[model samples]
Target: MAARITARRPSPERRRTARMTSSDWANPYGVRKPYGSNGANHGDGGEKGATLSADHPLVPWKQPDHVHQWVDVDHSREELDRFVRNWPDLGELLDANVGHGRVVIVSGPPGMGKTTLIHRCLYEVQQRVAATGPSAGDPLAVFVPTAGLENDGRRISVDPDGSFAPTRLINARIRSEITKKLLLHEFSESRVRAITAEEDPYQAYGEMSDLLVQRNALLFAVIPHIRWNDAHLRAAFLRTCLSHAHTRIVLFVEVSHGAAETAREVAAALSGSAAVTHLALRELNSEDIWRFSRSARAANGAPNGLVEPDRSSLMAAHDEWKPSDVRELRKVFHSAADALRRAPHPWPIDADALRPHWERRRAGRDALLRHPILPRSGG
Candidate 1:
């Protein structure tokens, strides 16, 4: 029988010391509290707000897992169809790269849903793996957000408690756990070997290379904004990963107007690598945008009797909600979908335009409920 692991209880003195250390690392502004602890009082010198509760919106859910939803990129079904259909190309590219030990770089402007597309591909691959099992050797996708890594490496102001109060400690913990799980799941045996190997700790890339070699899994590294100076190192890593025939890698760099030059430089460096395939994320066409919105609405179930209004209805509603322009409307719809997924309670639709329709439906239901009272079977 497998041995059971039990939780260990810490002594009061240890708990107090831990709390003090946590408080020391907490944010001065107290915007972000310590994990499992509350913020320090801003007005009072004493730690007044130290209650443990699930008040933070970012806290992990304790009940049923929420479903995922999306916003329409724009009002375009045709474009969405194209995007979904084109997703297979990514898988094909991955398979081809894995065969030859190559790298595929996905680069695009911010808000183009590059990360979302990556997640979608990973989700599909996971489903396939679930259906076919390990014998099929389904490709594993790991996302490493560079921003999180940078934040982890950067020094933060700490309090006497040795805690990061203002910093997003929960977010950091969640991300760390995610990264840990990905690494463990992808390279279990290789990880053990890497840890046991007698190598200089400073030369960490070599260990990563070893892990990749052992697992034969594809790594999806997301770098939001690429820097010109980091190009060489990034290129080196890609070259190393692709040196082995079983390892496939992809670097998704998200760029914006301010970082256009950096994107250009990085693109140039990646271009020199024969193993890398670079693709830019373009804006979604109107049809694609529409489809995204529709899909998001459908995934969230759109509520009973809340028929997804046609594009015409949206346009009409857009005219009425003037100050809340089309852009605002889109944002609201996106938020609504997200709420439907993440919110604990069913999201209520209270928009002035939607309210009347819902009210009418309620009235019809009430009438049906009263039908039995108005007429008897004999009458």
Candidate 2:
């Protein structure tokens, strides 16, 4: 997943997320695309250009670090129920990880918010970890995807043009950034090592697994596809059992019709070694689509007046969203948020200011189903 996410998108933050991970978002997917792809800004939930269309957006949106955090409008209690209500409770996951490491397998279809759920839970754990910095004996947590680290061993590189670039992919950058933002601490180098072919991915993995056995580290493994790497994953799971540290492995496997068999095989591998729990992400209903999505709220509070979409209007628009188009929702929100930030227009944007892009988005909605890897259901 890290490799693919990095290659598909050009956003460095997204790429860094693929490399280092560790975002507290319960939605565990990396925002970056794989290397050499132009559409990476859409991966994860970061925004690059302020607009969604080739043309400039209505509200100029710009933010450093590609993070788009739209402040949702004051929602009605009944309408704004958390989309992530069903998974193993965040408190439970944290307690398990902090007390005795746990090996949990979370399975969900692509775009079913698997990444989001993981990220949400991760953020809680991160906050807890940060509140009380870890000592050598305490367990530290790292969020990583099954794709492993994609960057070469070096932390930064010198380009031919003389611009120095980060050697690690966007994943590394994200892990580093999240630590500073949430934990108020720099990401420690000792916590993550650049895996080289010389050292081998599994060798590095093994070393990390050994730490878990020692009770020094906790790993949140994001398995993009259950069917993709059964044998290798099984080996890693077995390693956790050897740890006297109460080490545990948490797995988030993306599901498809054909994935169940592979999941069972992995469960069999764990057998007596680790306790396992299975979780299926909830499919988004219309209500969730509204809550998890964006509105003109953030800009509304600005000195300049803005157009705020009424609930009826917002629900009507959300109704058009295809459930499988979950990833697209992120793109839309990021784009809109960024556009608002950078737009040259006066304070508080109105619907008229947003209609052009909204129209374009709606027109393109049907095309999202053809998106590679994540098509909107019935799109």
Candidate 3:
């Protein structure tokens, strides 16, 4: 007697439901139904079963390891010479103690070339190091620009308008920006994470201080603007660097008329310490202006090679020209040079104005004069 064997099979309704469940799992929000089989319609709609393709590239891909080269500025020979001459003590100080732990502060009026000189120093120092192998523990120069401190503070989101939220904010923005950039560019993620996670901002600062000291790094701060409470900011900076006695920190503050008093006060505080040395920057002379124009023209290339005549020709033609005249010519060349650099079609300045041009082309002259780099006629 054979036992009757029966196997239970899923009902048709059950099979259909299973298939439907699988389909629902594949496209939960009915995106495929309305949008066809194409994987679209995932908009702001909260659909559950959607997934991005596996190979989608993300923003901020690992940047190549880049060594930031110092920026080059073209100052006239005269201006460079004058700066060196005026700040003879600074040159001496740098020469003597740069190997040791000496901090030099170059502060002065805006557009007076504080940034320029610092760049020059960095380039020179690096060049010296490269030419002659560094002595044991010779400090390596590091230039940090303080132009974007507010943005660095994360106070102003950098998404929309790029302006600072408030003008009165302390312009320690440069320090913040430089710190962020240095962290991003120079340090490892784990090291940065460890340093930044410290409770006090000054702790991270102290870490940088120690790191620089260990590496014998010379830090040059290019501060273009300062606020009323800049002393507090500077104190924090000094404390951070001074915590490690071997770290040398140079502060180059570019003083604007509005911020001159504050800059002076900050400089006074920094100067109170023997470790810090302060030097004021002065306006470039005509020769310096000429050299700057020439270098800028050569490096950037002038329009039609006519924006600025050869330096010798310019000097010869304008030998009798007043310093003011040379200044105006340099401005014209700078404007034309900039325009050439930025635009596909270059605007050429009148070659004659490298000497003297026709009065009829006054409009052209006015156009060139309108460049922001050019000083206003009366001023």
Candidate 4:
């Protein structure tokens, strides 16, 4: 018994390195660094970056803060109800455009949630059309994000079939969107192929519109950042509108204070001097920011988001920072959430708590600017 107790001679298998579960391998005293599928390190959450579970308290910060990013309110109704600041104004504009061949201009300052607002409104319009239309299926809402269209004006893409495509940049984008939506809705697969094969964007658009009309379904042609000076582009858009006389055309224009007159001219021409509905978004106030941030978190499934005291602290911090727009404010929130997720910090974080993060970010940015690449050695 004494000899056996001295230590059972380890078996060959038992002598091997002990197997450890992932939890045992994880650092107990420090944050576990996550790696994405590409082997890139991600420290935003215990999981992949921006993929935190819905119940996570840091969920709100996961939202993309870019001005051009369109939030799909169809999938996030809670966020739509909470963050959409200009719903009443948008409702009136959409109400006027229903079943009418009219262009509505949605104007707002940069980063004022113009794109998000339009997305939510259009989603609502789609739902209404789906529920009340004579069609058996959902309506089609085609969005053409013509970013950098000014530089890529009328540029053509070489097709895979080794032919020069006649479709312009915006029109081609529309065709692609139509084909994608049709396939998603399980519409006629043959029709999807036909739309994809069509070389003329306008003709493809007309054909798609005709199909939708036959189903008595509504079609929304949403184009954003359309300037008034692009006569050729505007004429092309007009042709599409003319072909689909009953389609809802929405032109989302970002309005700078200095360019008010230019925006008005754009609204006039795009509307063809017809009665145009206008929905203008105002800048976010302090309360709006607070409420929006809270709702954003809640929308992401954080039912226990910032309490009243925490919200007050956040608002004070935001006021002191004086973020120029919602976009900047979002960046602040995202950074704060990221920091908290990395290390569990006390609740109701104030300016003092957030200053370190800002300083670190500034230092990192400065270091990058000072030396974007490693210094070269003498050859």
* C-alpha root-mean-square deviation, each candidate: 22.4, 15.0, 25.4, 15.5
Highest lDDT scorer: 4
Q: TM per model? A: 0.43, 0.43, 0.46, 0.52
lDDT of every predicted structure (CA atoms) = 0.36, 0.36, 0.38, 0.41
Displacement of the residue 335 alpha carbon in candidate 4, Å: 1.5
Per-residue alpha-carbon lDDT of candidate 1 for residues 1-379, written as tens digits (9 for 90 to 100):
2222122233455434433222222211111222323322322122342322211111101101111333344322233344345433334434533444344454443334444444443344344444544553654555554444222211222223544322233223323333464556745745544543424422333344446545645555544332212345445533443442233444434332223435455456446655554544544443443343354422111222222324544433333332111222333453443333333333223243333333344344322211111211211
User: Which regions of candidate 3 fall more than 4 Å away from where they truly are?
Assistant: 1-103, 131-134, 137-142, 146-176, 184-188, 197-202, 214-221, 227-249, 258-266, 284-296, 300-330, 335-379
**Candidate 4 residues 104-218, lDDT tens each?**
4555444444555555555555455545444434444544433321212123223344233332544566556546766666667888788778887556755665565554443
What lDDT is obtained when candidate 3 is compared to the true structure? 0.38
**Model 3: per-residue lDDT, tens digit, 273-339?**
6565455544434454345344332111111222332454343333343222222333444444433
- Candidate with top TM-score is 4
User: Which has the higher lDDT value, candidate number 3 or candidate number 4?
Assistant: 4
lDDT of 3 at 19: 35
